[model samples]
Target: MERQRFDSHQEHPPAWISGYHLVYIQEGEGIMRVDGDPLLLKSGKVVLLKPDCCIEMEVRSGKPLFLYDFSFTYTMISDKPRQAEKVALSTGHHMLSAKAAVQLSLLLEQLEQRQGIEEPLAQWKQSILFQECMHLVLSDPVSSEETGGTREAIEKVLLYLQEHYRGDISLKEVAHMHGISASNFSGVFKKHVGLNPLDYVTQLRIAQAQRKLKASQPIELVAREVGFKDPLYFSRIFKRTVGVTPSIYRKHRHTDKIITLLPHLNDYLLALEVKPFATLPYGGNDHINGYLPYLARELQETKLTGSWNKPDMDELVEAQPGLILGSNWFPINLETVKKIAPTIPIILRDDWQSLLLDFARFFGKGDEWKLWMRRYEQKVMQAKSLLSLSHSSRESVMILTVTCSEYRVYGGRRQLGKVLYEDLQLTPPAGITTKAHYVCVNLEQIQAMNPDHIFLTTNNSNPSKEQIKNLKETKAWSSLRAVQKNQVYEVESWLNGHAPIKHSLSIDVAIDHLAANRQKPWEAIGM
Candidate 1:
């Protein structure tokens, strides 16, 4: 072992070396790129580099990097390799605790002291010290279930797999992408993810295939779309993983007593005209937006399910929904939920129209979705006509929601934002879908925007009288044209949305508040 310092790139090291090298940092910082993935390097961090792995570092300019480095090669029992073999092994990097840092210092000191040993007996003693030091240097379990290692990283990887399973993804590519060894990544991935990495990928493809199959996509097209080059092979894996051929799963998918967890799923189900058996518990939370009042009333006779992201195993089994419409937040392992019912994990994206169609396919409700769409279009025309007469000239509209002690301004693409800006032919004074879908701003900032009109939604079941009285008294609130003209008013609660029906209803509500003020926050619920 040796301590060294490098001030610049003048001394260019090879991209990678022959075997594993354990480098323990003492000072300075740099950015290390492994197979093009950048990882931050800092004091007390130890990086274990594997054989043939591409690595490059960008050191902090004018700062020297000080560290101890050692390298070793491993061989299986009863055999000695003449050249390094491409075998799967574990490698990791970590920040050391003070106790571990001290031990590493001592190990390095012992190795430095024994560098000149020549006697056979002395050599044996030196070998023992080397092994002990190596153990201390490489003892961390980067991806081990026994160590209860970081689970968040693995979950991120799982979500990536869910989103991109149709692409040509390999275990080695993912392991390297995350800066870990293939073997270790495989072990922990299976342990926490409940399937072998490749198996998980395969199941994801099969699930997508099932969706396409239900939609009546050709078998060959489904195979190609899901990354399989051969239709027969895809069918084989499909049957093996799902216990049914793609044809069978398509012919019949679990479709009754539906439950949706995320707003997108809930909205899509509502759009299909088949009320879900249950939905996420939102009525009591500080999220009095959207059509939850309607959902709450619907769920009175129906069951009220917990959030899909949080798995309450007993509660889920008891609810016994025949089909569960889940989002990415759903549990990775649905073994228990599967025992009670089929759980289809739907990855929610920003496009809601496509989302509604996908839900229709899953539940065999394409006809119903068509009927709803036809009616929704008719309703849209009626709304447009009503607005054109009562509210002409593309009036500037803003949607500001009150929650807790803060306020959130919705972007043009948000549920009700779409209704006002798209269907009802209004203008968003605050740019269309410009900010994050939801942007938090204070009262002064709202005054700066000074929208001509504001459709406020509060998380409170109804805006409190005291709060209302106090807000109006503020000079910032009184100066806006919306407040002066008494045009700032609460529309319907819009918490449960992201589907066609919700947007359709919100379109009506937006028109009512804008053109007629029938359900005005001050009068409808006495806000």
Candidate 2:
């Protein structure tokens, strides 16, 4: 056996004796002519050749091919004839014997040692050793179980399904591809792969759908992209597999305010639909800027408004608002606001979703509010389902909010953390809170938690390279799995603070960065 490493710029072999040859692609992808058939070879892939078998190579442009090539001849041992046979097969392609690699390595070492030696005895010994190696190589049994016919068939189906998942691929077509009847193929496939053909395809479709959803594509577009003609049908299937609608899934993935309002619309409406004269006094601070003014304007445009903005206490005796929309941030005196508009209803829009719902209710076109509300509900439910699944799956994460002086480790109260754990279905660290924007924690707490990923958010102040390096080098931080795996992600505070539509996109970026190294398919889906 003889071996040599070939570079991208190396000259082709001269027209000469082509005996048993084996090539291992270490890096780069290319096309190789094996036995006169063009075979695609990717990195970490290998090929084998027989005597007089024509072989050629074509590397992808800009990607120089790196390969290990071995050529050898075999002689009969103990009067037994040598024969070539397939060893391993994957997706219709066969692989050479595993020992081929070992033999090739040793042969390469021998050739290197005799680089300039042309002595007849040394050459004879090399030839004999090469023959002996080839004899041992060819004599090894091709494990029928390793690349069995059934495995080949299954791989073929998997590849085909992956390639045509967005098209109309039927069971009959798959079965016919392998020259088997649908019924027989179904039985064999199920017995061997543990899933019926259709179920397998659906699973693949769901995986693709999850990816598309995480990418923030609209549910309808995701349905169409995944080959589902009916968005409702797609929703049903997605809910069945993921236990949430796609819209909800996308919404829940982010810690936006909309997720909160989705589940509490009735409460919101109940608070908003009060009689003006019977309303309580709004006691919030007048200095605060709430959505009240905007709501009042919208109500007036819709023919349902009155002196609702900056109303005086005496106004309670005369004209009153039909409704009062307020939130936790409402600065007006809640008592005074309600009392001045006694007949008006006061609705609290504290959560992000509630604000959207409130806006839709007052400003949306006729019946459009209802549609929007329903969509919001779907989004929330989907998020809840994902959170439940993530919990069940035992996937863990860490949420960190970056600030100017130090980073704040949200301990379960931050809306973003809640959304990650309770909506998107990720198992956030138990200490993280969602009650406020973010909280501060030292490196000691992080080391103890040993989270799989760290979700970090930064304000206008970006951490300098030195700051990041110092943080990573801290004694308490060095022990953290996330840090060890380089999973520390810097997020923008605006994403975690503002309720703008762009918040959803920010959440996606955070998930992708935090879950960059996660191994599970769902984590990858979130990414």
Candidate 3:
């Protein structure tokens, strides 16, 4: 490992290096070429080189540059039984996350400190640290000019895989057709898609199997049709992924009594007209009791299992639910939940459309889902037409949520923002271009954006309400154009989750507020 520093700008003469090389830029800007492929460099950029690659570099004139150049030779073991093989690293530039950059910096520093050590123990430690550095670089998604072709190839390959997943497909053959090696194709495929190529194939097969099983297809026939040769092996994989055997899933696909562990997910089940057998309690001293106010009417018949922190295990067992729905927000012990019933802990992605479709397909309610979407789309069209009549569609809007601690500004991708910015085609305030779920902002930042209208919601707690009350009294709040125009409106906190029912309800809330005469400041502005 070598830490190379250029105190002053200089063009380096081209040189050839042996073994695999990793060049990490620590600071400053420059351009480096590996075999005439220009790689722009800055902080956190890495340049990987295959053995005997010609290297050339130029630092930005008058700027100091610091980088680490590490070289090593290694071979990877093959997954195939009785096969050991060597795989070369794909040479290119890659970008690292800030956290990973910091980690790599420290590892390189340690390796450099002990570079001269010859003792076996010290050498072993150095080897371990070098391996760690290699893992960090190789594991990162490749980002380079050289990788552009690889990315395009992988995308076409992905489409091909999806189109022919049910056939007897060999990933190696597919990679060869795309002009990429089998091993390299796996890494690139995973970078584009979130799963390994083989795992993706399995997922596609199982999803098809599920649809077939629900249609009363024989187990062996279903397995063979979906690319699985062994029925017993298929059953094991199915049980592991779906949390129930194929027979059990098919039997209870339509008749399962479900218990919802997450508060917001109740809206999803109810939207599909599947009333949950039971649900966890929702409110505290500051909001409506029992469940979310918007969903409470429909969920009245559903049993309240317990509070989120302390669920009633006895009631869960007594409900005899065939399944339990949980989410990333509220975690429960997998073993504990499985002991009662098959549990599906969904990872919430703040995408209501996809969530609704997935649940609809899972429950064999595809037609119901399509019908629901048609109605929702009709509602959206009506709302958009109404807003256009009032010219509110042309105005920029902002959605802000206040908790006891801080104020959050939602972006176009989350909560009410999705309805306003995407569905209704309303403009967002200037300088608010983030696609993230939200960003915390101060009153001064909010004043700077100076949106045409503001929609505010608060946490259920009284202290949160008090914070909103206090915010209204501040000079920063009083000076806003929306406040002066009386365009500020109070909305429900329940409108903030990405549930299908809640998303539809939020559109109603938005249109009602956007088209109405601005209510008096004292009438109903905040909590």
Candidate 4:
């Protein structure tokens, strides 16, 4: 970064650079030529120059143009070291957010302050701030909303291919499913997914083939398994895509590090005793994120990728994942993530166990999944037995969290609800048994249910203890049977404990805590 002020009518010849050049139009206005196009440079507008794009300048009518020029190379998630054009910097020009500009200025100031300093902590702070500034610069709120539909259409196509890719398919047939013409779907799919329909399917086939070949399966059988009727054609595509024949690739098979993006996927990976190279955060604090907090000691070393749905491309590239496991919960850009490695999206449905099994099968761990399911069943049964021994069969349990003082009863098929309502055979109180996502209950609504036991977790959203004390003083609270009986057990809500393994551990912890806290049957354990 350097500051320069040019006099009026000053003309500079075109120049090419090796990195992006962003000029913060501090004052005045001019015409900056970019890519042979004359872009009107003005105050409050950032002038972005791509690496190869030439910039010819002529100060137009105004005071001398004073600007801060920032030149930096972006090694972020691009397929190649190209100039950043897609992010708020292409076409004519775009408005920079005042907040973002201020943030960048602060970061730059910090960086300048630490130029000669040797403190590692100071340097790390500057680095993080600089990265954050870059992220903010890349962030333009308008594009995310506009591209949302585009992302969905592409995802729908991808899912269709996933479900039916093993059979003979064509572009028209798939496009018909989405009610779009072949030509339009082809263009949209390529634009968003970076591959035409035929190419995508062929790549999908090749990816599946690679796995089967690695298992030393027969070339012909593998071809049939991945949807190729003609083994000869399959072999040709395989060699082209993988750069090797099936038999040769199989002989050189080696395990590659898998990157699991969703928190549950990370826990699911850990359940098989296989550590991921990196994963997304299950929880902000290690304690609240996943089921096996104990195993977090091993996982704490893993990198927490940038965002959930749309992770930072640069981070994905750096991880160098052999396989990427993600969920459909986020707006994950399939085309971009695939550039780093083969990316697979797992749809998180009500059937989390089924999701786990799917992952297991992908990793060739079907047998392990079955074994885990058996042990999981055993664990559930044990927890159920212990819980049944505590409260009467007629007694009910309520699972809820206090979010900003309102009680959000966990309904629907979420993991915590499943563990309490289904796995433990614990009947929910009258209102919570149905299929609603969550019933927002005020103090009166909370008091109305008045169950035998209440299992409450604050999660990270609840009010402070002082606020709870105020709630307890209300007539609505004192009238509750659980509160009067001292059965309002405050438990940890494992935010990341949505996976089978994590849910199992969470179930045990809940039961143990419930058994220990209640005065009736398990007071023996509590004290």
Candidate 5:
């Protein structure tokens, strides 16, 4: 047994195993890819690796990994009288209980101490400790569940296929690993995972290809990224699966039948003048069929596809959408959704301007974004001119979001904060010093800053109504200069969404309240 400590974010070179190996994670967490299948490495978790397996280990960033590694050959006593035969153990991972892990560590320590001791008594003691360690491994309930049943084995194979599908995977080699014929394994895997091994691989590859295409990546490069060698063949397969040519799909010119799994993504589709075929509700209640009041007019004809968390799959199927846009936060299963239509998981950033540009470029609406930005800049200039008369640039503005339970103060980086501090070029309260997104504060902290203006809003409507009412009754709230001057503007709570439509609407609302101007030319164009 060797104690191995790997540095943070370190990736070990790929090594082929000559004997059976077991790794007991002593501290930290990471991933170990065995024959191209990833296994999560965490504290108290043990992994068994079989002979001839290729393995690579990677530690997560800022987290150093420590493991107790044991490698040996195995000989089992057979049921036959006085017979011993070599046997191979299965490859899988199991979580060890805290008590069992501690006992195993003690046994390993004793065995390590006995290493290199050539005396007969020392060798005998080492053998006993090794046997005790093996007993602890074999007796583990989770380990037995991982390696004992055919169903469990098939599940592991499914996960392996899901991770390595982009690589060149062979049905014969996969079947051989399970000690079965290719035909038999295919039938069993199809029964369990709902698709044959090869078909499942194709589905995974094509799903990834659709995401790359949406990002405006080159067809040739996208092909190579998803395991396709020939760009022409990739295009043909893409057309066959997606019902449009690759170029047309990338340009987003073929269909308007798009489904947005998240509500704010609807704002992006609308800004591009592409009405979504279906969308999820905006607020918490799934049964309410709620849409953001600002976006309701544009989405009136669009179908409501239930909640984002648990979308009605039948509604999605009936829509016959050519594409589905979603984010990582959506709880719907990606594989199941991909079966209905091509789904792209969006990576969201805090900057709404960049997100708008990304969406515009994705849908071949760069000219539209440029046109919209011109109108937006015109509106910003007008609003800034009006603000210059009523307020100075050095005066502080605070965006305080009240929920039922807490208060969150936004700095210059947040959506609403960008409109006030960045777009309008106003100042943030002295209390908000960090570069983090938003900071949770108490009433005492709010009283200390005493900004010139305060934009008060709830995270969502109804829940914080009483909270806001009670807050206004406080002495600290009544003593503020902004409160005395009637500068506490209660704006729409839905301004929390980070989207182009939200940004435009926020500016309109801010100008309306702060400068007493109701002009909404920027919002008019999108509507």
Candidate 6:
């Protein structure tokens, strides 16, 4: 598949194009008259045109509009006409879903990076990625009847169930949530999802229980935490799902303990390298964004250092840092590092949960990891307990930041985004997709949303004092309540000052700063 963006106001080819053309609107607004049928285009929306379709587009935006266009071809071969029919039915060609858009963007980025590379290795990697894209296009269910309104409903229910798996939810409650009779809901859900409601609930509970167990929790407590009322029944379900008793599963899960020396630490014996493990935030430059603080706390609780990036290699050679955790993207020269600290170990952490597991094993704190995880579960419960609390009469306020020139507005899903929604309970405006870890929104769109507070992420290196003063003086910015009231604030980049672990502290400070200006100062607001 080939992906590119077009922004020509002049007319181009009038001839029909072969293969599928999927276009996502990135900015501005326009209309494409396809075969004399007008199709409106707006930001965040995607349109898919089939092969050999006549097309003419007219854009009306003041500035150039951006569209992400993907083109691909597929061959259909079959035993008979029926085979061709089957191939046509099975081939994936549909409008890009919001989730698919995020994935495609990631793939396109990788492909762009290798566009000029000449190595055979680069060619092989590109070929593999192209094949994967083809597979994704052909396997997506959007073109099938299986993915209809009922399927969408099932997806929503599944999401809700997954998010609230720890809570006491029943089939009747789920049915009522969707405003359907229990029997009808159960039949339709089964037909579309291939699992009965009760069975689905049981599977979700069991999966969560397994995660808890793997973290080294006691089986009985894990069972109750997952909503299993009876320990014996939970054991039966666990054995049926995993082919082993809970206790046996836990005992055998730790069978592997292969510790390899980091490319930088080959000189020391494995036994001599036994020291506390520490992890830095995945991205070295923190800027107080994402789940770094939570991950850091987990690391510290497990007796690991929260400051992995600032490790003193010379001191570590003597003190022995059993393992230093980093991400796969770090730019360290591992060979040189190993020569310097041969006695220390190194581990890479890709996600929050995996980091927890690595800490558990390295510190011999497997059991403690389980206990802390349980406490996390309890904290979640306490947060949900406020569902019945009276809603506040105060107006809601949101903090938005614009760092890069793209004028992107951060959304939930990025560390800062997720904290804003899940932790601080702020609601983002509609028509925004969770594609960009920090969303890129145009200035006009930001004004349209009209958030109460606009907290800009500024580096001293950028937006020099003069630029900052000019921006504050702009007519458009001056109209904003935040700008008018001087609510704008600057946060340092992680390495420069705002390290990942310090983000929570920064957020707390920002909240207090905002609260001090609010009319209702008594409202609770803290990280």
Best by lDDT: 3
Q: Rank candidates, TM-score, best first.
A: 3, 5, 4, 1, 6, 2
Q: Which tens-of-lDDT digit does each residue in 212-320 have in candidate 6?
A: 7778998779988998878999999877665457775565444332222221111111112222243232333442331233333332322222233343455445544
Clashes of each: 5, 52, 0, 1, 0, 8
Q: What digit string (tens of lDDT, one per residue) describes model 2 on residues 1-527?
A: 33334445666552334665656564454566655555666443455565665566766423366666666444333423455543332112344443454444345445556656799988887676655545554455555643576655765676577668888988898888866667788887786556988888887787677767767888889999988999999999877765446775565433211211111222233233311222222122221122222123222322212232333445433443433434443344566555532212234332555454434333211133333333333333333333344322355677775444676665434356645654455666756544545556666766767787777655434453345557766777777877777776765444454332323343455444543332232221121
lDDT of 3 by residue, 1-527 (tens): 88898655455789899998888987665667778866566667787788987888877524467789888887777767557677866776656765576567667767877899999999999999999998898776556733677755765576677669878888889999988888787887786566989898987787788888978889999999998899999999887666567887787676548888887888777778788888888865523458778777788788888785557898888888888887778657757887988787877886787888777767756545655674566566556766876657778789899999999888888778888888888888876754767889998899999988999989667888999999999999999988999899998777777878888878777777786443221111010
What does candidate 5's lDDT look like per residue over 1-527, in tens digits? Answer: 78899886455899898898888887665778889977666666788888898988888534478888888887889777668887757766676664577567667666777899999999999888987987897686654333555555575676677678778998899888866667688887786556988887886777677777778889999999999998899888877665556786776544678888888888877877878888888764222347877778878898887764667888888888888887876667878888887777776788767777766645655546655664566556656766776654557788899999999999877678877777788778986843446899999999899988899988665678789999999999999988998889897777855777788778777777777445543343343
Task: Quote each prediction's TM-score.
Answer: 0.48, 0.31, 0.56, 0.50, 0.52, 0.35
lDDT of 3 at 229: 90
lDDT of 1 by residue, 1-527 (tens): 66867675655453866688878886665666777766556566777788787777667533577788777776544346466465645676766654566556556666676788798887788678768766776674444543344454664576567568878898888887766578788887786556889887886676567667867888999999998999999988876665556775665465456766654456566666667766665543344332255455444555555552555567777776667666675454655566766666677665677777666655555545555654455455556656665652366777877765677787756567666666566777664353337778888888878888888766554444345556778998989988898888765555324557577667656666666433321121111
lDDT of 3 at 176: 93
* Predicted structure 4: lDDT: 0.65
Number of the candidate with higher lDDT, 3 or 5: 3
Q: Could you tell which candidate, 2 or 4, scores higher by lDDT?
A: 4
Displacement of residue 292 (Cα, Å) in model 2 is 22
The true-versus-predicted C-alpha distance at residue 379 of model 5, in Å, is: 2.0
Q: What ranges in model 1 sit over 4 Å off?
A: 1-255, 262-264, 285-291, 296-300, 305-312, 318-321, 329-340, 430-436, 461-469, 516-527
What range of 10 consecutive residues in model 5 has the weakest lDDT sum?
Answer: 518-527
Candidate order by lDDT, highest to lowest?
A: 3, 5, 4, 1, 2, 6
For all candidates in order, the CA lDDT equals: 0.65, 0.51, 0.77, 0.65, 0.75, 0.50
Question: Could you give me the TM-score of model 5 versus the true structure?
Answer: 0.52
lDDT of 1 at 269: 67
